[model samples]
Target chain A: MLEIKEIWKTFNAGTVNEKQALRGVSLTLNEGDFCTVIGGNGAGKSTMLNAVAGTWAVDQGTISIGGTDVTHLPEHKRAAFIGRVFQDPMMGTAPTMQIIENLALAARRGQRRGLRWGLAKAEKDRYQELLSGLGLGLEDRLTSKVGLLSGGQRQALTLLMASLKKPKLLLLDEHTAALDPKTAAKVLELSDKIVAENHLTTMMVTHNMKDAIQHGNRLIMMYDGRIVIDVSGEEKKKLTVPQLLELFSKVSGSDEADDKLLLS
Target chain B: MTVFLNALPGAVSQGLVWGIMAIGVYLTYKILDIADLTVDGSFCTGGAVFVMLFAGGANVWTAMLAALLAGMLAGLVSGLLNAACGIPAILCGILTQLGLYSVNMAIMDFKASVAINVTQADTLEKLLVSLRFVQGSVKGDFPLWRHPILVVGLFTACLIGVLYAFFGTELGSALRATGSNGNMARAQGINTDFCKVLGLMLSNGLVALSGALLCQYNGANEINVGRGAIVIGLAAVIIGDVLFSKLFRNFALKLLAVVIGAIIYYIVLQAVLAMGLNPNYLKLLSALVVAVFLSLPYWKGRYFAKPVKRGGAANA
Candidate 1:
């Protein structure tokens, strides 16, 4: 459902800080494919996802969602076909806005906002039902500001918002990294449930190798600026942390793996 | 004390007139989370547009509408500079404000100021609100209903009512979201740049409306009328937020708080002057007061923040 062709992005192009963030990287995901991405720091994992999200114009690339070329589309325009959950919990929702208001905003994605009342009476019941499904009791606090919710709750809410309208693609950029283990596990489980329920095409960036193996129908490992390992279906299901580290060591030509990636 | 009492009605009327401008400032400052310095020049743009059009024999409403449109244009320039050109927000506002000086001068035919000949009966009768109405009402020359206080009070109420409704709309909610979280807004498919421009237009439009009213009230539009206007706007918004944020939880009430804040600001100014302070030092005093109030929240965060054990699934 999503197509990316040989994308290249360089930061600070000519200056001393110049770094090629993405170098001829390319990938394609089929409809209903939930892909987990793993990479060490500066692996260009987030950079690749950002390239697909149109955070900035790629130096050279072509991206298409559902056969529509959106290579030059601005971030907000690309939003019509994409849902994104940022790493920072605060980045995914407006703190001062109410719970229902944030949901309403997500529900109206790809639609023109007009002079009509922001929260429709008919949608309130639907949102309440959806919130209740999360088991967070957010249904009772429709008018409460999202800022009052805890990190996990906010992350859960953001997950709901991202999949609210079932976009062509959903991008999760290490969404639960900030939370404690238990909460992160809960949010990850929630992500699985939501993706299955919605049959969403999702790309989830994760630091945990075990998680990269455990979840998703497909898994891809990024190293240095390109995808060096791609595993799917039965192969992905049988993948283990040790095997993945072995693959990484083989691909990176190093005896020592990235400490942060291994520890996480 | 008696002198202060005698000036109280005029002070209140002036406050009500400025209260409209404060509401405009509230839109950008509070709602949009932008300190748009465009008001410094747009205020006079409104006055200049209104007075020139009114002098040219346009209806008062038409003149006011022109003034509002002029102000919106000024806001558009600043919005484009900031959003499209990617200039810093403060710098964009400053650039627009600086450019507006010449625009205001040109609007007044290169003159520094323009005065309405209120001595003429037609002109006097045509004005919506004026200082003469304030004094005349006190001496019973005009009815209380015709007083500038009553006239401008109605204007403020209607303005707040309109704003309250607008902010509740889908477009308005998106605008608020843009201010609250631009990244979130964009992810949700909101054109945040468009929202920012619309907000600036709306904000400067109201500011111009207030300026036009001020010109009518004072019987003149001076080039320096808008000098320090942003400070006063900020003063009113901060004062309102400090005093009434807790008491007024509703959107409409928050706007009313801003108006009342302006009134309180004017009342305090009158009291200080009554105590023999020189009028020449008024701007300096206003600057200091606003500076202190602006620093208050930062001080609280830096000096008084409590350490809290934060994070985890338990809180969630």
Candidate 2:
């Protein structure tokens, strides 16, 4: 469903603060695959997802979504086939806009916008039905400005918006990191339900080891701008934190996994 | 008291004319989330276009339309500088405004000022608005259309109505979304650059129209007519926002608040003049008022803020 070929991105190149975010990283996802990505800080997991999302032009790479190369497309143009939920809750939606309006915007994702009315009477009813599915009571507040919503509600709304038009690839960038535990669990569950129902190809970045292991059909660990270990299906189901650490230590040729990775 | 009363009608009419320009500022400042200084020049460009075209024996409406288009062209330059050339929005507007001084001069036949030939044999009957008509209407000898308050008031209402509807449409919503959140708008494939450019065009078009009307009312277009125009517009917007934000919940009513704010501003200016203040100091007074109003919200949030109490008293 998505392909990344030897992508490379360097920030502040030729400067004192130069840092290479991605280096010759390549990965491909099969159709209907829900992949969970994990890494320590600066592991390039998020950078890899951004590369595929076309947040900026990678110094070197070719990325394709559903067999169409989109590496050269600008961020907004590439949005035609990509759905993104950012790490910051505020980045995913317009705060000053209303719930129905936000959904209506997402409904036109990948489509040309014209002089038609932004919100049709029928669209409100449909958004209400979709919001009720989240069980957040959002349907009751369709016209309320999105800024008034709690973080979880907003993320859930963002999730709904991202999947409104069924993009070819959905990118979730630590979407639940800022939420309270209960709310994070609720949002994660909502993400799972939406992706499953839509049969969407998804790449979800997470900080929690348990979550990375528990959700998704496959899991990949990134370290120093490269994928160190990838486990899937039967192997992924049997994987435990300690075993995963041992595998990471072996594959990364490191003495041991860092405490931050274990603790997180 | 007599001086103040005598200035009231003139203040109201001037306020109504400036109110239109303030509405244009509201689009960029409040809607597009930009403070476009381009109006400082485009306002004069509007007057220059109107006066120059009307003097060339064109129809009055044609002159007005040309003025609107000229203002929009000025906006297009600023918008491209900001969006396409990668300059900051404020800087882009400043650049366009600076360049427009020369452009406006050229448009006015390289003259620093120009006037409508109302005294000419063929001109006075074609004027859409004028101070003479305003005086005639006050004496109850002219038609209702000749009243500045009525003519400009009706025009403002129509402009507001059209804006209110336009903002509710898909393209308009995309523009609003772009202003509110560019990142999210792009994620939705909104082509926000196009929206920004279009918004500037729409905003400056209205500003030029306001300028055209002001020129007609004053019977002259001076190069300095647009001086401090941005401050006045910002003052109107901030005043309207501070005063009527809570009372006016509807979009159209909010726009009306801006117009009312301009009227209040002009009425206050009239009072200051009645009190014997120098006319040249009026711009200084407007700047101070805007500065104070702009800082009010920040001051309230910082100085008078209540502590955020937690659920438990101990947590507070």
Candidate 3:
């Protein structure tokens, strides 16, 4: 469950580079709701996800997750309730660290790290089991440096890490955008399986319209820093590319969809 | 050649003493990914604190402990400036290092140097390690166990063992994660700022401990004793990494390589001095050596790197 109320964020205010990234945006997601977000460049889709993640304080409005206000909380503090997978595969895992070490870090999310040995003998079996489930054969490379993994593998590991502690909400910001078509599809499929298995409430920002349609229970399209189109339940299940494009044209008052939105 | 051979023991002993400081630099430089300039000041701060307390009748261990604490305090200031005040990491270290000059001077009663009255038999007898220990052991006047090389070698071993264990702990792993990927660390709920500060404290504490030992060994703590200390520390770390990174994959062995690197650095310096190099140019030579070694990786990547063929023919 997540609540965001009229959040406003502006970057570089009073400067020539000023841009309004978010404009009085509000959205709510019920428990176990997986929301797919779609928008062209500079449409604030990623900005909205970042606001919920508390990457920075919004200029106005409040946000809460699982019934607790996190508007004033810092990014790391808010991490207790949120799992994040970044657009860049390198951003989500420590490259110089080992695979198991990264997983161990994720296991202790929201908990104080003390002087105990980082990897307990008992937890190794559990980690190997989880890695095997990824079907990437990472279980055999527990001590291998994560830097050596492929981009798709790293993204998959990041997804596992994000869901390791079962946060209240998982945020995926174009997590597969950097991978090749085959790898991207694989990672997306992995994301769906993981989210479904965990019953995780998720907000996934994607540029691909087909992916936007093919995944998640609810769909929202952002335009000009605001949510221009939102459809859910039976309405979303029956939606197609043409209908979504027509709705975007109606709400955005544009004869054609943005080239990126249409083409991507 | 005979002179160089005769100087081997002293060079090795001095190298072992400085190896401790190099280990401290390794923690911040390699582990925390910070180039903390504070060690240049904190090194003298340790020596100053040790000499003042020891001359004032404190026990040897108490004085050394005070030295380590003084160094840790210096690191804390730099850490707070960088982490809490959000000053740039390099600037924070520079500020703390500059401030520590005045503090070190005051600790030594505004003197340019402080001596431990090593001419006094009681003072000489009380020192844990000294230049005299090397000669006295060689001459069989003192027990071989009292040799500076042996004592300092044991110190380095213990330090490496402790660091290896600490780095394997949960808190240490978090610190490693902070250095390797700060964004990932924060998302995993690690307090990265806290880890950075803690690392600086631990690093400077060891540096100061080395400085205290050096002051005892040299018979005096000079105001300029710590000048170019960071360069020496960097030289040791870079040299060790270049030469032994492949061979020493284990954490404890890696630390051992750093100490060995320091020893090798001193031995080379001794050899150059034996070949009639002017002592005044020593710092310049050290600077150039470190600068060259530091640029090797960049040059290798920029100029010597070859095009790679991936999963196909070379032309393809």
Best by DockQ: 1
Model 1 stretches with alpha carbons more than 4 Å out = A258-260, B304-316
Write candidate 1's Cα lDDT for A92-187 as tens digits: 999999999999999999899999998889999999999999988899999999999989899999999999998999999999899899989999
Docking class of 1: high
DockQ of each: 0.83, 0.70, 0.71
Question: CA shift at A112, candidate 2, in angstroms?
Answer: 1.0
Per-residue CA lDDT of candidate 2, range A194-231, in tens?
99999999999999888999999999999889898899
All candidates in order of lDDT, best leading: 3, 1, 2
Q: Residue by residue across B1-316, what tens digits does model 1's lDDT show?
A: 9989988998988988888899989999888899999999999999999999999999999999999999999999999999899998789999999999999999999999899999887788889998899888768877778899899999889888998999998899999999999999999999999999999999999999999999999999999899999999999999999999999999999999999989999999999999999999999999999999999999999999878766756554
Off by over 4 Å in 2: B120-122, B309-316
In model 2, pairs of residues that clash are: none
Candidate 2 chain A weakest lDDT stretch, 10 residues? A255-264
For candidate 3, the per-residue lDDT at A30 reads: 98
Using lDDT as the yardstick, the better of models 1 and 2 is 1
List the per-model TM-score of the A chain. Answer: 0.98, 0.98, 0.98
RMSD of 3: 1.7
Error of 1 at B220 (Å): 0.3
- Residue A145's lDDT in candidate 2: 95
